[model samples]
Target: MTDHPLRYDINLSILFTELPLLERPAAAAAAGFTAVEFWWPFDAAVPDGSDVDRFAAAVEDAGVQLVGLNFYAGDMPGGDRGLVSWPARSAEFRANIGVALALGARLGCRAFNALYGNRVDDATPEQQDELAAENLALAAKAAAEQGAVVLLEPVSGAPRYPLRTAADVVAVMDGVERDAGADNLRLLFDLYHLTVNGDDIPAAIDAYASRTGHVQIADAPGRHEPGTGNIDIDGHLAALADAGYSGWVGLEYKPSGSSTDSLDWLPRARRSSS
Candidate 1:
């Protein structure tokens, strides 16, 4: 509702994964998003460069930007299924980072969200942090070369991830920066998770806005579009803008009903006026 400078990105996952992956970006652009993020275009069996190139072309033809990419999930082939639980999976995780970096480079995206897989029962909290930090450090180094940033999002209630608190997220970034000599690494602040996990959203952003590179939002109850449930959507947007965040805010929520039914929120003017 406030006059914020930040813009939002539509993810194909929320809009058109039900359609063929190739048509997802085009559908998103037609829905009025100027920018779109994707989970993994690499999953498509198109030729080496063709997969990303076609997707990038679709984004451009549809008059949108590819702003964010989600590249790291633990299930990457031959890679460890859980980074937090299996510290030794760093090698495969590095390969996953490489794939994401290449995709970012090809798609002209500035950020990639790499998820630290589920927690391992064999590791201590301290050990998980150390392993995550080490793995992230390696990722940051690779991302830096592509002129992109890698962000770690804390899954507070999901103990499978190492970053559960703002402090924990920041600590991981700090560790990567210190160990890899790259301060460009950052945290991806998901407001839904933050609020659900009992974090003071606005206050946390004010404190660590500089370290936060991207944001995602969803209503608390159903993880649906803003205003669908009881999350202060307007207030959250204002807080993010006030904190000097100038990047794309991801609408990483499920549409409660039909995906297109949520188009009423697309026009920024309407969203702000609401």
Candidate 2:
């Protein structure tokens, strides 16, 4: 595939599973990635400071720039999408803001993916949305202080996830951006999820690429590498570049086999954000 006008970063959270968390950065670097991103490194929103320090040191030693991170999303394996809207987890989410920002700041990460919480049995859609807006406002403000942007993404395979379309996410962003008072809040623009949810990728890019803070790729039919499915990954990325999206394209897909082996499709020459 020809190179698109974009930077590339590996999502260590998904790509280097065989290794322990602390080891993933070096593994990515060995695989030719100079930049990486992750979901929360710890299962809990707040881990011991020592654990945090060790993770930071690991990335530092590996010499990979941490580009993007997610705010604490509770029990991802159990299907919880995020904590930004759940009333019960509001305190946890708020508490996580400081920890997330501090880590991102130290790593010089400019993008923070804030997964909107799922629909809870106890809260109505309106109530949950209201809470999400408030919480996102808080995150956006804090992220701005560190010169980073808080990203809201529409996720698929998440039945309870409220943001399933680009429109769904932008509806909320309209309010958050107005409140943020700067460009600190933006859409994540995951191509696979939007395609899975039936949004026209080209139209979505035409509408939202200018507002997108970050981008992720995974082919549809299966969330694997670009050529493993029917999605025209390269064309879409080229369109995004044409539409004014100039940011990291995070490789957030699940591998069909060994993570390193899954990367045979990506040339080492195109791995960095040069």
TM-score of each: 0.86, 0.97
For residues 1-274, write the lDDT of model 2, one tens digit per residue.
7357788899988888989889999999999989999998887888899999999999999999999999999999999999998988988999999999999988888888889989999989888888888899998888888788899999999898989999889889997667655457789999899999999889999998888999999988899988999988899999999988888999999999999999989998888666
Residue-wise C-alpha lDDT for candidate 1, range 84-128, written one tens digit per residue: 335656565666776667667866888977777766677776786
* Model 2 ranges off by over 4 Å: 179-182
Q: Pick the candidate with the highest lDDT.
A: 2
- Judging by TM-score against the true structure, name the best candidate: 2
Candidate 2, residue 137: the lDDT equals 91
lDDT of each: 0.71, 0.90
Q: Whole-model lDDT for model 1 versus the true structure?
A: 0.71
